[model samples]
Target: MSNKAQVLVIDDEPQIRKLLEITLESNGYEVSLAATAKEGIIIAANHPPDAIILDLGLPDESGHEVLIKLREWYINPVIILSVQSNEDDIVKALDNGANDYLVKPFRTGELLARIRSSLRIKISEENNPLITCGEMEFNLSARIVKKNNIIIKLTATEYTLISLMVKNEGKVLTHQYLLREVWGPGYINQSQYLRVFIAQLRKKIENDANHPEYIITESGVGYRFVCKE
Candidate 1:
């Protein structure tokens, strides 16, 4: 009966799989290896891991499709580790329910950090409704947001937008998803509307609107709410 956090590595590259197995095991985590999307999904379904490190390019099926299938039942974090660094692929993965994305030639330390962050967020979500990041605090139940212990005034739209981001902190929220959730299905293509509201939220919550620390822009994809602690 081992209590170590289990991490499943799903990659086609033997080298990548070996590297992750070593990195994760040495860092005190139990590891499972899979070279194909089919095998990976089966292993996950049998015994779910605390987190998953998945690659986009698979011989059997695309990792994006695999992620979609896993998200249907698996609620744990799924971090995309792939060679595809384009905005389209990144946005697609995030939209499909990946918790984080890292380029193929990534740093082991950073991957470990991402795994830790994702797992911690899972625990936090289950244990509390109050989310604190740097100088900000969000009381999900009361619908209150505070900065430096002072309540910040926010409109219904602003609060909804920020609340959505805060709830999924550390994970990228695609523009389409955010717009659809905050506004509606009709506003999914309204990127400009999202930008305006994001800017407004930053101005109210961020110490420096020009250089935001919490609501980070993911270039042409979307925004990722980071917890600065």
Candidate 2:
């Protein structure tokens, strides 16, 4: 059999880290544990796992901070596993470099699915060049987004949603497509999230977010990105 997938679990709470270890090990993953972001970073730089699971409430430093530090060097996917369910927390983690997250008290099944999805994204991004839309550029190769010569921060979901639309520029992706691609098929019916995140992407990418020129709505259909002039 292939070697078990490697995962680094960073959380201050022993119970949370232990649970993650148990869940991941049982699911055929080799797990590493860190109780603080400081140690987490050291462990990550030394061992560089295939993926990372981080908690927002770290004992030494915030997970967002750790994410930023790791992102400077590590391109592997970082999934935030936090109890902080607020929109601000989610946005902060994603903007700082998290690939996805799970709300606290999450199900083992859901968590497993999320890890699988993240691994898929990491593999797909390998060897892919940057993608551009309008005045904005998404450097998939660099994991950076720039607009109008300025860096615009994007949450993981927001970035995923925008990247999908831009990659399929001019094609109106139905709500199902957007939802499934970003949030996964688990939230295919949550159409309102599409509205919220599209607005976020336009505000950061468009010359006039009020009347978007990059992302367009299709009335009864879904949204599409006009990537070419």
lDDT of 2 at 185: 86
- Candidate lDDT values, in order: 0.90, 0.78
State the TM-score for model 2.
0.58
- Candidate 1 ranges with C-alpha deviation above 4 Å: none
**Residue 216 displacement (Å), model 1:** 1.2
Error of 2 at 56 (Å): 0.7
Question: What's the CA error at residue 24 for candidate 1, in Å?
Answer: 2.1
Cα lDDT tens digits, model 2, 187-209, are: 98898888888887887887888
lDDT of 1 by residue, 101-208 (tens): 888788987787789889887887774678788888899999999999999999999999999998888777889999999999999998899989999999998889
**Clashing residue pairs found in predicted model 1:** none
- lDDT for model 2 comes to 0.78
- Which stretch of 10 consecutive residues in model 2 shows the poorest summed lDDT? 166-175
Which candidate number would show the highest lDDT if scored against the true structure?
1
